[model samples]
Target chain A: MTTQASVAPLDRAPAPETPFFFPSGDRPLYAVHHAPVAGRANAPVVVHCHSLGVEQVTCYRAEVLCARAAAAAGFPVLRYHARGHGDSAGDFADATLARLIEDALAAAREALRRSGATHVIWLGVRFGALVAASALPLGPPAAGLALWEPVQSPRDYFRAQLRGLLYSQVAEGRKPTETVDDLFARLDRDGAVDVHGYYLHRALADSVRDVTLARRLETWNGPTFLAQIEQRRSLAPAHAALAEALAARGAKVETMRVPEEPGWHMVANPAWTSPELVAATAEWLRAVA
Target chain B: MPWRESAADLDRARAERPIVVPSAFGGLVGIYTPAAPDVPSAGLCAVLLTRPRSHRNRMWVEGARRLAAQGFACFRFDYHGTGDSEGPTGPLDPNRPYRDDIVTVLRVLRAQLGGRRFVLCGACFDARTALSAFADEADAIAGLMFMAAPVVELDTLVRVDADRKDWGHLARSLRNPYNWKSLASAGRWRYMATVIGRVARRSLGAAPAGDPPLGAAFVEHFQALLRSRARALFLYGRDDAEYESFRIAERTAFAKLTPEQRARLEVEVWDGTVHGFLEMKRQRETFERALGWIAALHPARAAAPARTIPGDATPSAVAG
Candidate 1:
C-alpha cells in the first residue's frame, strides 16, 4: 500500500455555516465554519489557528473578534479543530505538524470551494503562529500570514508547556525528574502528559521542538504582521529579528508592539488581560480583508 | 507534546447538561446561607444552598421542590470550606469557619419569618451540620428533614459507600501537597486520619475502626443517632446502586437496635430509584412522593393533603 509518499493537497468545500471535516487519523476533522453573514461571499478565506492549553480557551476572545473583523471586511473565515482538538479525533500525542498542516489545508481548501475566496490567509496566536509558520504550504499562489507571539524558539515553547505541568507536579512536592525531556519519551509512550493532561508523543514533541519559526520563515509569503507585546520582557528576539529578515527579503514587514498590556501567555493577573488586543486585531482584519 | 482541545466534548457536555464545581480552593471565598427571614416572603423564595462534600445537595433540590409546590421558602448551603460554596474543597477546616455563615443565615431566616414557621432541611452531612449549628430558637425551621442521614455513612470514605464517580477527584485531591507533607511523620493521628480516608476509598471496602482514626466508630455507637429533633424523615431510593447497599447495611445494623433505639427511627424507600432518584423526570414528583413519606411519619404536622397534582406545576414554576 502507499505510505505518506507525497503531499496530497486538500480539496475542501465550505457551506453557509457547515463545519468542514477533513480525514484526520481515521476520523473526520470538524470545525465551526463561519462566513460573512451580510454580502457576496467571495472574500479572502483566513484559516484562524488557535493557541494551546488554557490559553486556547483564553484565545477564544481573540478568535471571535478576528472572525467578526474578517467577516465584516468581506472575508469568509474557516476555523478547523486540529486533531485531538474539539471534534477532530486522534490521540493528542499524535498531534504533529503534519496533521496540523493537513487540518489547515483541509480547512483552507473548503473555504475556497465554498466561498470562492481567491486568497487564503493565516491568522494565529502563540503556538498557533508557530504551527502556521511551520506548515503553511510552500508554493506560489500562497496566502499571507499574521502572527502574534510566535514562540521564536521551539525550545522555549517546549519548556513552557512541559515545565508548566511538571513543575506544578514538583511544586506539589512530588518527585519530578531533572527535566521535561527526561519524561517526554516516557510520557509520550503513555500517550498523555501525565500531569497536564495534554497529549504527548515523540513525533508531536519533535515537530514542536524542531520548529524555529524565525529560521523557517521566508519572504514571498506577502504582507506579514509580527505583532509583539513589550514591557522589558520581549518573548523572543527572534520574532522582531524575523520581521527584519522578511523586510530585507523585500517582503513588507510591520512591527506593532502592544505596549501597555501584559503578554497573553501570562493571564493570572486580571488586569493584564487586554480587550484592546481583541479590538485591534478585529480592526486590522477588517481593513485587510 | 502538544495538547489538543476537548472542544466537541465540552460542546456536547454543555448542551446536554452544564455544571460547574470549582476545585477545593475555587470560587468566591465565602460561605453564605439564605438571608435573614426579615425579607418579605415571596411565597417560597429561592435560597442559596451549600453543605460540606455535598453530593447530597442533589437530593436537596428534590426536597425543595416538594415544599416549593406548597409555597415554602428554604435553602441548603454548603459548609464554610466545602462543596460549591467556596474556599478549599476539603482538608475540612477543623475550626469549622463556615459555621458562622450557617448561623447567620438561620438567624436571618428566623428574623424574616416573623413567626411563619420557616423550614430548614439538609441531606447527608448538611443535616449534621444543621443540627450542630442552627437547631434552636427559631420561628422558622418548623420541620427538619435529613435524607440519607450522614452520621452512619460519614464513617466511611464516600468512595466506598456512595454512587459518587467523583471519588477519583477526591482520591487525587487528598494527595494535596499539604496533606502529603503532614503525613511525613506517618505516626501522628492527623496523618493517620488523612491516610485512612484516602486508602479507605482506594481499597474496595473493609476499612477497620483503628484505620487512621477519622473519628472512628463502633457499630453499636452509630445507632444512637436515630433520635430526631424536629420529626426528622429519612428517605432514600431503592434503585440507587449506592444507597441500596448503604440502606441495606444501615437498616440491618439499625434493625438490631433495642426498642428505645427503634422508636425515634422512621425509614422509607422509593423502590427502583437511584441515589437522588436521578433516573426519574419531574424531580417534584419524586420529592412529593418523599414528602408524602415524611408527612406520613408526622400526621399532625402535615400542612397539605399529601397529594401530588400532575400537569399543575413544572420545575421552573416551582423555582419561583
Candidate 2:
C-alpha cells in the first residue's frame, strides 16, 4: 500500500508572484505581489517600502528572497517602487519626502485591499523604514513593523550619501572641485544635486536633514522587529538605543543582531542570499501572524 | 508658463504599462513604454537587455523613458531569475549569455507589440549578450547600440591594476602633500603591494591559467553584422578598460572590414565618462547620440503613424 506522503507530491508549489501598477495620486507606482500558499486564515499582508537611489538596486535581490520566504510562511507580501524610482512613473527630481510618505500610505492601503486582510505589516529597509514610520500616524492600522538595518538618523544618512558622492567623484579621477559645503550650496541654488544618477532635490534633502526615526515613531506603540545587520556579532549602538526607546514606549520590540555584511549597500555577488536574515524574518512573521 | 509644463507634456505624450512574457524558465516581467502620440513613430521597437547584478531600474528605466520620448517604443525586462521575474537565481557567470531569454523576448515583442523591425541595446555584460543575440536575429534587427562591450574574453580573467590613461591623475595626486598622508594607512600599503606583485608576475611571463584569447567566432559574427543592412553604434568612456581591450583585441578584425561595412558602424569615446556613465552630463550625451543614430537608420519611417497594437488596447492588467 502506498503511504499518504509517498502517493502525493512532497509539497505543493507556491503561488506565482504577480507584477502590476497602482495609482498613487496622479502617477503610477509599480508593485509585485507574492501570494501566500493556500490554506491560511486571516494572515496579515506584508508591504515592503524600498530604500532610495542606488541602495534600492543593491538591496533588491535580498528583499525579494525575504518576501518569498515570508509568503511561504503564510504572509502575503507586496514589494513596490516608490514614486520617482524603479519602474514607477515619475522623475527623480519630482520625489520629495512628503511624496514618499504618501506613496507608502497608498501601498499599505493597496496591500490590505489586495490581500483581503484586516491588518498589514510594514517591512522597510534603510531609508524606507523612516518613510514607513513617518507615515504610521496617517495610515490604515498596521499589525506590525519590520525593519532591516533601518536608518535611525536621517541627517547622518544624507551626510554619508554626500560623502559617497565625493568618493565617486574621486574614483572618476576628477579633482575635488566642490566641497560638502559647495554641494549644499548647489542644492540651495539649483534646487538639486546629482548623486550618481539620482538627483537629490532641495525639498527632499531639507526634509531628510530635519527628520529622524525617534521623532517620527514617538507615539507608535506596536509590535516591532528590528534586524541590525552587520559583520559584527554585537548589535550596533544606534540600533540598541532605538530598541530601548521603542520598548520604553510600551512597544513589544524584538531585536536581532545578524552577523552578515549589509548587502543592501555593498557590491556583492549577484547570487548572494542572506539565509540568516531570511530565516529570522520568517520566524518573526510566523510569531506575529 | 508654469515650471511643470514640460513634465505635464511628457506625461501626456507617453504611456507605460507592465507586462509579463511567458518563458520556459518562468514568466518574465517587463515594462513597455510606448512612443509619444504626437511624435511620428520610427516603426521600430527597442528591446533592452538587463545588466548583471542590477535590475532594470538602475539605468534602463530612464533610458527607456528617454527612448519613448524620442518616438521609439521601448521594452525593458528582467531575466528569468532577476528583478520581479520568477526563478531561482543561478551563479553569476559572464560567459553565460542569456541568449534564449533574449530570443524569447524578441518573439514576444513581435507577437504583443506587432513590430517587425527592432533595435537591441545593452551595456557591459548585456552588451556582449546583445552581440550574441544579433547573430541569431539579424534579419529582424534594424540597429544595435553597445556601451563598453568587452571584445576580449581574457579581459574578464586578468585584472588590470589601473587604467593606463589615468597616469596623469595619479602623478598629480602623488605630487600633492596632502595625498601623501593616505599612504600611511595599512590598507593603502597592502593595495600598493598587490599592484606591484601583479605587475612583476606579468613581466616575468607568468600568465594566469585558463585565460582564453578572443574567440574567432565572436569576431566573425560582429563582422557579419557590420556587413548586413543593420547599423551599429558603440559608445565607450575613454578611461574604461573595456575600451582599451576592444581596441587591442579587435584591431586586426576591424582592419579586414570593407570600407562600406565600416561606414555602417560608428564608435565614440567620451571624455570624463566612466564605464557606467554615472554622471548626468555623460548619460544625456549618450542618449542623444543613440537616439540620433537610431533615427538616421530609417529616415523614411520617421513620419509614419504609430501602429495600434494589441498591447495598447488590452494591457495585461493583473488585479493587485
Give the top-scoring candidate (DockQ).
2
List A-chain TM-scores for all predictions.
Answer: 0.76, 0.88
lDDT of 1 at A264: 37
Best by lDDT: 2
| Top model number, TM-score | 2
Measured over all alpha carbons after superposition, the RMSD of each candidate to the real structure, in angstroms, is 18.2, 8.7
Each model's TM-score?
A: 0.45, 0.84
The clash count for each model shown is 23, 0
Show the lowest summed lDDT stretch of 10 residues, model 1 chain A. A1-10
Model 1: CA > 4 A from native: A1-26, A37-42, A53-55, A166-177, A184-192, A219-221, A229-235, A259-273, A286-289, B1-320
For candidate 2, the share of real interface contacts preserved is 0.28
Residues A101-219, candidate 1: write the lDDT tens digits: 76666666766776677787787777788767755654114457788766677567666667766656554456766587776666556654433323345566677665677666753
For model 2, which pairs clash?
none
